[model samples]
Target: MQNKAIDFKRQVNIKLADTKLQDALSRLQTRFVEGRSAVISEIHHLEDTRTAAAAIRDCVLNDLDSWLQKFEQQAIAHGAIVHWAETATDANRIVTEIAAQHNVLTAVKSKSMVSEECGLNDALEHAGIKVMETDLGEYILQLAHEAPSHIVAPVVHKNKEEISDLFAEKHQMSRKTGIAELCLEAREILRPAFLNADMGISGANFLIAETGSVLIVTNEGNGRLVTTLPRVHVAITGIEKVVPTLEDVTTLLRLLPRSATGQSITNYVSVLTGNKDAKAHDGPEHFHIILLDNGRSSLIGGEMQEMLRCIRCGACMNHCPVYQNIGGHAYGWVYPGPMGSILTPLLSGLKSSPDLPNASTFCGACAAVCPVKIPLPDLLRNLRTRQMALGLKSRQEVLMLKVWGWLTLHPRIYALATKIGVRILAMMGGERHLLHTLPGATGWTDGRDFPAPSGKTFREMYRKKSTK
Candidate 1:
């Protein structure tokens, strides 16, 4: 996938102007955010659960190499093959090779985020293999040729009416206005794909090092089907997903579904250990797990290591003000919202995605709701610091910051400048008292007006209070 993250502001502009996209994103907050808030109280001790979850993830990050090795040894012992990938391209190539080796005709996917990061669909198509997305949101995106807007809810940028139209056109069937009718149409169309697909691909929620099992939770039963029925199954996930034990997985599961979809438990929780046994007649014949680094290893023992704790729950984005307006596509990558804002630049290159670090309001809402207690705001600030240190900021912005720093050093002059600037702003406002446009800030006022200062500066107010 060509990265549009480089065009952050441009994409944001387009997403903001799109009222339909706005309406679609609003539903994300209503359904996910409100639902999460309502269900969190059900946890015996929400904070304690979050703490335990964070500790388990941090424990893995502390010794990720050992756990991954343990997982590999255990998985292989159980008849599953483990592959390591240093880059997204490497992971894609590995998957393609496996598909070719098996003479796979059709590949059915179960919404793997790492696959999106690896551009596996494009790579498979390039290799002359047919790829089918089994997950409903991913299937919709596969038909639309659009990237996902959110991590958990990939098709949040789309509404039912638009999906209905797409389904009718893509399925080449008569339009179905009702949601149930459209779902049935998709099911009928996809059932054949499930039965005929030679290979299955999915993303793992947690890789239990103790049992060497690939655990994934889904409301839709496609995860189970994609792993089964097909002769070959491939599970791809970031190396950070590995945990020490199933008990740790059990702890994380308490937070994942609740934070992601507000469900106390997902309808289907599949723990796939390996291929079918000689005595058994079910499960995939060949099971492969791809552990993708893709820049994750570099963050180990660093300022950004906390980022690896992410479970793709997407609570950060659901409550994000920026995401609520611009949606995920504006982030210009598969990962979106606060997590994407940090991950895109970290996993991809900062030079390619310079605007992502600054795409936040520093609201800390993302950090507050993060189930694993990732300090997202602090990490975002770290990226901004790195961005500035690397000369990623424009000359004008750098100069402005320098000037502001100098003014801060001289309080009297800074106070005088602010006082005069406010008076000038007030004069410009006239009777309307709203500044439609201001100096040095362009396009910002295009959408809304800024209120002119109505009183003295904070310093002046403080001095007056002291005198009183």
Candidate 2:
């Protein structure tokens, strides 16, 4: 597999320079931020619910094996087939096997990060099955041949004009302006795909073990169509998505929308029990639930287990300074933002994505706003420590950290080194008060301006204050 992190950064840099993309990003930020803030302000009990939700997740993670088995039993009893996948490859193989057995020619997909993780579309395509993404954001990205830029809003990186152009080229339609027109254009094309698709795949927002229901919350109706319209429905989700009951799911639901896009509830929250029963009018004949482990089993007893509590709200990404600047693709995986920083390395391994865990500013925004109260910043720090222990950090960075560690053990040298570093930066910048180019500071200055450090060190200031 290619290193998506590197490519994501390169793509972001290119996108950031484009005026249209910048405008679209700015508008998207304003819309989501304000909307979410308003929703949060309206809900006085949101924080309390978040606490409850966190506790629920804590309990689930603690007894994951039991909960998973219970979930499987309940789902199977309801006429759903539950398949366990220990790895991404296993998950893909399971989905492919099902499709092949059904003689599926085309599959319609709702937005599912688990599917993205398994590279499901690629696998299906390689197997000679056409897969179409039905979500508006995902559909745009599919047309553009790009990965999702946001967990919820996958095509947040593309501007209206770019989307218009992409649609025009792909479908041979005339370019149009305005959101409604663009949406209509997309609807015109995707409606047929939904009706004609052989199989439908989706990701569950929450899976209730008590009732054997898979809950899909969406602003658009695509998820419902995807799950019910096709002959076969496959729901792929992580093992951590399991909850004990609808009441537990309700607690999460209360916090999820407010923290995500700030809605009271998303427009659509469809609870699917199983395949279409004799009494049902419209629904899939076969319902397959693929529970993907993909390194989550190893994280169960570790400090990073808290990461699995994430509700995929995208609140963290919306509030994330790095995500707001570079967008989701930069994380180089299906998940992005503070959650992604921890998850990408854990799922993909630190060696495959050495830069991911270190991509954080550790601002605590993700943790503060998390609906399930996941300690994202702390988990990120833990991942960084693990990465360092594995010797995945750059040689220069490792040597610098070693020298710094040595200095810290010896206070006199630490003070001396700090003073010297300040003086050197001050001399290099002169009166500009900015170092445009510095050996170690290039990354900082690449996208944003970096201020030069003041000549006076904190130690020097502290010493003078004590003397005075």
Candidate 3:
């Protein structure tokens, strides 16, 4: 498959030309932005709550090892098995081993981005374990054999008709079925999967070190069922998900759902504290928490350490203009948008995704909406610097930047160039006042209308005003 960083430019062009994808992404992102703004506006202490949340995350990250050990000890005390994996391969191996030990035939999973990052479903399937996605959005994606487009709404890119068709082809449902009917059909199908699942796997929104609890927030009841109904429950999450205390979890929870989906809280928030009583027969008899490092631990005490504070609320992506235009699939990875731009290159290596850092408009909307206030634009810039230092940038881009730098150092030449360029553009614009294309800048004008220049540079305008 053509992936991001490798075929990003082509993918972006494809997404931009796809009117349907553009329309769907625009509506979904607009709704999410408005919803987040409306709910956050009602919180009088929004800043304080976010600040507390950031501080709590920072504390855990600063001493992450200690907190993780504490969580492991407490979880063990509560009759849970805690496993640590330093890499994605290691994590997949651990889960497969556990499934093998239990001879797990089928496993049910809730929406866990970490598991997606690890490619857990394919791993389990390769090991002869049948995996079922229980979250409605994830279930839809699973059926379609697609990756999630958005963090909060996984199948946001899919329209109802498309989904109806998918269900019809995959589940023998009528193609003419409405959305409600489709949901009902999905529910009916997933209910049986939950009951027959040999094990349940989920992602943790937050790991409470004090209580050894795995906190999960979901709109569907699938999260609860996945954790409670199976013979075994497994949670795979990043080491950064750990927090200092329950109070901290409460503070972060206030900001997470509001920033993510514009709700004060998700419909269901389940806290699994190591199978309180395995013999009770009401919940899972076996509880396991897998902590995956996957390059995150290396970020500590580094320039990008603030990235560790992210709670994965996805507010950054919702408000990003670039993300709205190109959509997530163009990003070519498990994570997308601003967070993905930074994390993908950091995790996958700068050479693997040289274009990601340059994907943003650097408008700062992402940093502004971020719950923990990660400087996303700055992070992107940092990645760009890293890319340049490693000589990963194309020679043409480097030469262009060198020429631009030279021009900027000579003000007179720069002004002269700008004035000439504007007059040329203005002439090209003619009556339409729009340039259909620009020489050597086709990428900028390919899927957008470039506004005509005013025939005068900013310097000329300022000079005339000063003379007056």
Candidate 4:
């Protein structure tokens, strides 16, 4: 993960200068933000709903032990096998073992970020099983050998023309294919995979503790097929996804789509409690649920606990100034934006991604748009504090900050330094209000000019006015 942070700085430089990439990000981010704003306006008491949703999440997280135990008992009663994974390795091994035991040659999967987090496809393939992604965006990314740029809109970074080229090269389709035609071709390819797959795996939007059910919402009907058509169905999700009741799920469902894709409701919402009952013969006969902890449990009583309240709506990224500039891939991880900034360090360790928390401008746009109202800016600041306390920052940076702090505490020396600094910069600026070059800050001056200070200091002017 530390390697990823080191790469992030390099990637951001390239991405910022790519005009085509910037254009695509601007258009798509605007669309999502506008759609969400419009839908939110139409809903009555949306803020109240957000508050209630936050409270419910807080309740479940506070007493997670009780909720998880009850959920496990109820799920077992419903004929679903429950498995607990304390780490990503455990999760991948569990899913692979299930495939191996059932003699599953092929597995079809819906959009599951948890699977990405655990690297499930690679694990399954290593065990000699074929895994096919059924969601259109996910399938496109899988074929291209790329990770998702956005949470809900996995391939948002890609344009239709690029996709047409990919399909033509990989699927032997004509390069002049249209958007609708590409989708149809993908459907034709995936339909057979779905029918032949011996195992189906998915991620849950919310897990119901009362009913022992997993709720999946998607625009495409692929989620329904993945959970129902195969002989064995498996759901892998974070333990934080569990809710106490269906009514709590209803409140969250209303916020999920509206905040995620700006829809009143998703096209498909599949609720699977167990596999098949006595009357049902078509659905998966064997059902399994894998609850993954993967560093989430350690955050329960910590400052980052608020991060667990995220619903994965992508609203924070959509509104983030930094994310809008560099895009998600530049973050170099499964999650991105303000949520990713906090989560990456917390889950991976503050020393791993020391620069992530500092990536923000602290504008707080992410906090404003977050459905669960996680104070993202505060959390990010806390990460920075942790990093500094751990001495993770470079020695040069720490020294500069310490010098600045000492000067700030000494009023007379600070005033004298500011006066001298203003005169020097003003002399350098000459006729211009901006400095095109600055020592030790080439990164800031390389792309844009820095404002030059005025010739007169505020303290001098204040003294002159008082004497008059």
Please tell me which predicted candidate would have the highest lDDT against the true structure: 1
What is the alpha-carbon lDDT of model 1 when measured against the actual structure?
0.91
> lDDT by residue for model 2 over 354-389, one digit each (tens)?
777777788888888888898888888888888788
lDDT of each: 0.91, 0.85, 0.89, 0.89
Choose the strongest candidate by TM-score: 1
List model 3 lDDT by residue over 324-352, tens digit each. Answer: 88888888887889998988888777777
RMSD of each: 1.1, 2.2, 1.8, 1.5
Model 1 lDDT tens row, 109-224: 99888899889999999999999998899999999998888888898889899999999888899999998897788889999999999999999999999989999998889998
Cα deviation at 215, candidate 2, in Å, is: 0.7
Estimate the TM-score for candidate 3. Answer: 0.96
- The TM-scores of all predictions, comma-separated, are 0.98, 0.93, 0.96, 0.97
The per-residue C-alpha lDDT of model 4 at residue 193 equals 92
Error of 4 at 76 (Å): 0.9
Please list the residue runs of candidate 4 whose C-alpha ends up more than 4 Å from where it truly belongs after superposition. 1-3, 461-468
Where is model 2 more than 4 Å wrong at Cα?
1-3, 6-19, 445-454
